[model samples]
Structure formats: C-alpha cells, structure tokens
Target: MDKDTGKAFDFRLFKRLMRHTKPYRLTFYGVALAAILLSGFAVATGVIAGDIVNDAISPKDADKLLFLSLLMLAILFAQVLSQLGFNYYANWLGESIIKDVRISLFQKMLGFKMTYFDRSSIGLLVTRAVADMQRIGEIFSQGFFVIVADLLKMLTAAIAMLVLNWRMALIVFALLPIIMIATRLFQKAMKVAFIEVRAQVSNLNSFVQERITGMKIVQLFTREEIEKENFRGINEKHQNAWLKTVWYNSIFFPIAESVSSIAVALMVWFGVLQNVANVGSENTGIIVTFIFLIELLFRPLRQIADKFNTLQMGMVAANRVFKILDTESHIDDLGTVEKEDVKGDISFSDVRFGYIADEEVLHGISFDVKAGETVAIVGATGAGKSTIINLLSRFYEINSGMILVDDIDIKAYKLSSLRDKIAVVLQDVFLFADTIANNISLKNNEVSVADIEQAAKQIGVHEFISSLPGGYQYNVKERGTMLSSGQRQLIAFLRAYVSNPSILVLDEATSSVDTYSEQLIQKATEKITEGRTSIIIAHRLATIKKADKIIVMDAGKIVESGNHKELLKKGGYYSNLYEAQFMAEEVA
Candidate 1:
C-alpha cells in the first residue's frame, strides 16, 4: 500500500480530474437542466396536493379537486420523463469521460522508462487501469448527479417554503447551519476512513495477484499454509477497514436524520401555533404541504451525505490514478528530431550509468563497434553486461556519457528512429497470446505470409511450426508458456531477423535452448549479424569463440579484450574461463 498518511487533499488534483469532463460540457449542461426541472416538478406536486386537500375536504368542491388530481398526475409524468433524460445523459457523459481518461493514462504509462516497470508492481498498475477508472465513473454518474439534484431540490424547496410562510421557512432554515456542520464533520471522517479502505483494497489486490501467480512455486516448495496465512492477514486488514468505514457512517447517518427530525418538529409546532392565533382554525392542508416539502429537502440531504461517502472514495482512487498519469517519463521524444537511416557505427565514450543514484553500475566504460563488427561480451552475473545493451538501446539513459552513431550523438536522433535500427532477443522471450505468425510479425499485419514463412525457415523453426496442427496460425499462450523454451527462442530469433535491423543484440539468447536448437540459433545468428553491428552476451564460451572481437567483463569493468585465438594466447580471464568450463565437462 502507498503511504498516504502525510498526504493532504489537493484541490489542484481535483481540478485536474474535472478537466476530463470538458469534452462533454454540452451534455453536462443538459443533464443539469433536466435535473433541476425534474426536482422542481417534484416539489410543485406537494403544493398541488395541498390545494386539492383544501378544496375537497374544507370547501367540498369535487370538480376542483378532480381537475387538480389530473394536473398532478401530468406533472408527475413529466417529472419522470425529465429524470430519465437526466440519468441517460449523465451516464453517457460519465462513461465517455472515463474512457478518455483511461486511454490517456494507458498512453502515458507506455511512455514511462523501463525503470518504472522495474520499480512498480503489475497488480498496482492494473488496479489503476481497471478498478480506479470504474470508481471515477461511479463518482461522476451517481455522486455527481445526486449532489446536483439534492442541491437544486433544497434550494427550490427553501424558496417555496419562504413564499408559503416566512416564519415557518425561517424555523426550517435554522437547521441549515446545523446540517452544514454535521456534513462537514462527516466528510472529514469519511475521507480518512475511505482512504484507509482504498489502501486495504490495493493491498488485498496485490496479495491475491502474488498468490495466484506464484501458486506453482508455493506448491513446489510445499508452503501453501504460509501463503494462506499471509492472504488471511491481508483479508483481515480489508475487513477491518470496511468495518471502520461502516461504523463511521453508522454514527453519521442517524445524527443527520435526528437533525432533520428536530427541524421538522420545530416547523410543525410553530405552524400550528400561527394557525390557532390568527386564523382560529387549523390549515391542516398547509401544515401537511409544509411537512411534505421538508421531507423532500431532508431526503436528498441524507442522500447527499451518502453520495459524499462514495465521492470521497472516488477522490482517493482519482488521486492514485492522477499520480500515475502525472509521472514524468524519464525518456521523452524530442519532436524536433527527425528519423533517418543509421550507419550502425556505435561508440560509447566515457559512458557512466546507474539504476539508482550515486551507485554507478557502469563506470566510464568506453567501446566502439566498427560498422558491422560482432562483439561478444562474456561475464559473470551482475557484471553489467545487460546494462550496456540497455543503454545502447536507450531503454535507460546514461548518467554521464555520450553514445554516438556514425560519429553523431545518438540523442540527437528521434527515439523511434534510434530504436527502429536495433533488434534484441533476450533469453527470456515474450510472445503475446497470439498466432505464431502474428507473434513473429508483432501485429504489423502487413508482413506477407510468405515473408513470415521465409523468416521462420531462416531461423530453422519452419518445420517445427509446420508440425503443429495450425501451422503458421498455431496460437501460443501468454508468454509462450505452451511452447518449449527453445521454440520460444527460435520464434524470437525469427522476429529479430524479419526486422532486418542495423544493430543486433542477443543477450544470452541461446542459453535456455537445447544443443540442437543452439546449433540452429548459431546459424540464424550468423545470417542476422552478417552485415550488422552485433553484441552477444553469453556464458557459454562456444557461443562467443567465433566473434570478430571478444570482451571479458568482471566487476563492472572490462578485464580482457581480443579476438578468440588472441585471447586464448594471452592466457588471461577469457582463457581461464574457457579452460575451466572444458575441464569441468571432461571431469563429468
């Protein structure tokens, strides 16, 4: 859960959320008008009822009462139609606004740097996209409509009561200050309680996602009981939060109702006293009408209080949503830069970078790949091999360094242009839950079937795909979980080959594949890197032995560099790693 204890309600953020409603301004106005008209007609019916009672009971005018009854029915019918219009328009506006917000948020999230994903949780992001957006829609559709209608009803009722008898109106209006004070207190309490509820909800969501995704690992380790206990703890926290909110609301609603009841009592006593002192007879119809109007006022007041609770919850959700939308992506596209063909001459000069501040991962590392050279990087885990490729692709920015392509700073090129020239295949390949052909083409859709088949053949996965029931149309599950590790890697290779990039990066690409797949991948790699600047990071010496140049890294520094035979002759780190691996194989 995000620590929001010290966070205060920001009015500026509320204004930002409201800005999304700008596109539906006309619809909002129409809904507001319809709500006001509907509420007015509702209040007027009480007045008509009073007239009918006075005529039928006291005056004994049956014709007058009959006509008034029909009039009331017509007004009620109009009120219903107006209410339906208000509801339909309000719903349309709310849904449209939320749709725009969700789309904009998704676009912003996609632009965020890779580091954002490393630090953020998938469950939390998904919660914002799905759950939070829905909360916002509820606020607009239900809360907004209720608040507006209640305010209109209250205002109109107060005016009508004042016209009927200013004394009774004053008596009733006295409750306004008391009601305001009560609502203000309830709002404060509900805001804090609802915020707690939202936090607990996020925590519960995160826990459920973790448990489900890691269930296999839990079962393998036989730790189901421990996982259940952890889930129970989170569930109890959510339950406690809800209980606290209900307790606050339980106290608040009755207090508001008691205040309304007190106002009603005062009005009735004063009204009866006035009738007896002056008129010498009870104007029971007037008394009843006054009571009906007061009920109308208090009904919505109670509803408004309830709506306030939901509105506060939605505000909490909006704050979280806006925080994500407001995040400034560290990587931005400078629109002034133009896309152009890249020569593939890559150079890093005095490059320094870090994932976190003040702890440099790459310290003044410098290297150059002459137009179409194949550079192999061999290093132990966490030696910054992947970091180098990440910086080259601008998936991350260098802290203090200059990367140049064709002797020009790569930053000067448009990000899309820079990335378009590069292709990468990592050991962990990600294939969408799509057909094998669609996965390879990445939804370009314009790539011909023949082109896909040729690329698959080049990567030596053509026959394997043909063996499947659906051939090229064979669908892979999310992350290609249905396919073998080697098959996924081969598809990744085909994806890269089809792009025909100027720079190729294969980071432990063949590490997970079997020996037969590895041989096929080696052949594919040679063809893909034939005329491109290639960087291959591999633990296996066999994969890097044929490189034009080899770089051996240790502790974030280049410990050795040379051709395969030259490095072997030097008898340094590379030669030692090679001999050690071979000796281990011989012993086995």
Candidate 2:
C-alpha cells in the first residue's frame, strides 16, 4: 500500500507531469489559445446583451436593433466553434500525453531487475499503468485548461461589473469572501476523500485480478464462497471510498449555491434602490448585465472547486507514476563489449548472491564449463538450482564475485549481446496468446516460417505439432493453457532451438512431459546441445547420465563434482540424491 502525502498542490509533481507535454507543445499551445478565445467570447456575449437592452431597444431604432441581433448571433456562432476547439484539442493533447507516458512506463518496467517484480504486486502495477494514467490525463482534458478559461471569464466579468456600476459591484463582492472560504475548505476535504478513492481503486484492482487469475486454485479447494465474501468486503471498501467524495460534494456545492443566491439577491436589491434614487448610472440594462456577470462569476466558483478535485486526483496519479519512473532497480548494462561470435565457455568464480540481504542463496559457489561441454546440476528442491540459472542470465545481480563467459566478465558484455547467445527452457513454459509458429519465432521476422518448421522437424516434435488442429498456426491461448503440459514443454524446446543460441539452459525442462514427449525431448536435447554449451538442472539423474560433468549441490554449495558413474562410485551426496529424488520416476 502507498502512503498518502496529504498535499493539496504538489508543485514538483506538477512540473514533472508538464514535461510530458513537451512533445505535444504545439497542441498544448493550441489548447491554451482556444481557452483565451473562449474567455474573450464569453465576455463579449455578456457585453452585447447589455447593449441590446441599453442602446438598441431604448431608442426604438429598428435598423440598429436588427443589426445588433445579427451581431449577437454571429458571436454565439463563434463561441460554439471555440468551445468545440477547446474540448477537442484539450482531449487530443491529453490522450497523446498518456500514450507517451504509458510507453515510457512499459519500457521502464521491462528494464527492471527480476527482483523488483518479485516484491511488487502485478495487479497494483496494472492499476498504476492503466487506471491511474487515465486520471493523470484528465488533468489536461477536464481539469487544468478548463479551470484557466473559467477563471479568465470570471476576471473579465468582474471588470465589466465594476465599470457599469461600482456600488452594485461592491454589493456582489460582499458575499465573495464567504464562498472563497467555503471553497478552500471544500478543496481540502475533497483532496483527502479523493486520495482514499485512489487507494481503494488500486486495492480493488489487485484483489479482483488475483482472484480471477487464480480462480482455478480457488475452485479446486472449494474456496469460491470464501473468496466471494472476501471480494464483497473489498468492494464495500471501494464503494465507501467513492461515497466519501460524494458526501463532500453534496455538502459543499449547496453552500456554494447558497452563496451565489445571496450575491444575486444583494445585487438586485441595491440596483433597484439606486435606479429609484436617480443618483448614478443605474439602469435596467446594467442590472440585466450584472445577472449575466454574476452567473459567470459564481458558476466558476462552484466549478473551480470541482475542477480542483480533478487536478488533485491527477497530481496523486502523477506522483505514483513518477515514483516508478524514478526507481533505480534496472539491471546495470555498463559493459561496452558486444561479442556475437565467441566460444561458449562459462565460469562462476567464487560467486555469492542473495535474494535478500544477509540471507545468501548462492554461497561462494564456483564451477567451470568448457566450450561445447554439457553439464548437469542436480539438487533437492531448495538447493539453489534455479538461482544459478537466474544469475547466469543476469536476471538478478550477484552480491559479490564474478561470472565469466569466454574469459570475459559477464558484467563486461552488453546485456542484449550477451543474452542473445543464451537461451533457457524452464519447467513452466510460458507461451503468448498467439499462433504456434509466431510463438516459436517470437515474432522475429528474421526467422521465417520455413525456418521454424525445419527446427521443429530436426528437434523431432514436428509430428506432435502437425497432429494438432492448426499445426503451426494453432493459437496457444494465454500461457498455452489450451495445450497439455508436455505439449507446452515441447514448444519451449522448439522456441529455444530456433534461436540457435551458443549456450542453452534446461531447468527441469522435461520433468512435466509424458513418456512419448519425454523421448522426443531427449532426442531434441541431444540434437540441440551438439555444438553449444548446455547447462541441465534436473532431478531425474538418468537424464544426465551421459553428461561431460555432473555437479551435485546441497544448501547453496557444490557437494559433489564428477561424471555420473564416478559420483555413483563415490557413494556420496550425489548417490544419495540420485536414489531419493529419481528412484520414484525410475519405478514409475
């Protein structure tokens, strides 16, 4: 959960948001110019109404009245056009700004270290990227520029009032202080209410997203009723948060309306008295114009309070988004080396690392794999098997020591160039909601459809894929849920094979497959690892029997290192783990 800063106006945040508009400055300036025109047109319409009553009608000059009526209609037409430009251009600018911000935000998220995501909520991040971004955009579309135009109109109206009759103008302003103070109070109260609203929105999004994504787990354990009850509680909180804003609006707008009525009544009372006394230039026309001016002034007083709420919500959203943009959790790609044609040799020299501080997962582990060698790392469930893979790919940085590839520190290579030579197929294969061919190629135009088919055939999964309804064109759906676990694993193998990486990683890759797919995977494994350095992490000791080296780990340290038969001969940690972890699979 995020803490509320309880600020009414955050200038630093405001400036940060304004910087997004730099790319669309021309549209921003156009919107500003339209606002100015709108204010001017508004004041012109009010002044013309006054002239129609005072000069055009009083002398009963038919020609002058006809000309003035036509002029007023023309002004109204222009006002309509200006209003359209203001609304359209403002919204255009807002959408454009949010589009750019979302792009940057997505790019930033893509660059963050995997550990950052490990501790962050996917649902809450979705809320920030989608819902909160909309609110930030409303700052331009419905909040900032509209308020500026309204304020300009009010200032113009106030000047017109003073010029016509100073006494009546002073009477109108007598009630102004009361409304101003009420507005100030309303702004503060609504700020707090809206902050609560934003917080609840994120909570609601997170809850709903998690429940929906894990609905299978909920139903499997017969927890649907309990989950629904939990959701109802969250929904209630969300409703209550919104209702707080509603309650504030109900209380404040009425006070503003009462103030507006009082001002109108006072203006009418004094204007009538002065007209009767014949002391000043008080006429029916002046009183009529004052009515227009009063509406122009008091309406914005009511509306500015509402717009201020919009502005406050936008500021809150900006603060949240900027927090993500300011995060320094991205992986450091400081190395200038961009080697694409290198021998596949990997070394971990005294590598130490932790997912959390002072609780190391990899404790001074060291290993070396010669070019074109196949190595298998076997361990119990929490024996830091997967951590080695993550560190090799640089998904998480090591706390101390060095990881070298081809005699160069892994950190001393450009990230993309380094990762391009490496590929990993995990036990849990993730496929996008696209066709099988696209998933295999990863939408890489360089790998043609023919290339994908050739790789799948060479890997021995071509028959299995062709047996499906659409074969290569089959839509895997989200995370390949439509396909069986074995099928998904085969797809992962094909994906890696097509990339033709110099280094391959298989982390329990064939553990989920059935007997037939397991045979296919074994054949694919042999073909793919022929000319590349391969790292295999498997609990099935039989699969790694022919490896060039076998490294057995326990509690983050390598306990045994030898060929499979040699480790078995030693009757040490490897022999015991081989019996404990793989004997059941051998029996089945």
Which candidate has the highest TM-score of all? 2
Q: 393-465, model 1: which lDDT tens digit per residue?
A: 8889899879988777878878888888899999999999999889888888678779999878776778888
| CA lDDT of every candidate | 0.84, 0.90
Clashing residue pairs, backbone N/CA/C < 3 A, model 2: none
RMSD of each: 2.2, 1.4
Best candidate, lDDT-wise?
A: 2
Model 1, C-alpha of 166: deviation from truth (Å): 2.4
Please write out the lDDT profile of model 2 over residues 301-420, one tens digit for every residue: 899999999999988888889899899998899989998786889999999999999999999999999999999999889999999999999999999999999999999999999999
**Residue 505's lDDT in candidate 1:** 95
lDDT value for candidate 1? Answer: 0.84
Give the poorly placed runs of model 2, Cα more than 4 Å off. Answer: 1-4, 280-282, 581-588
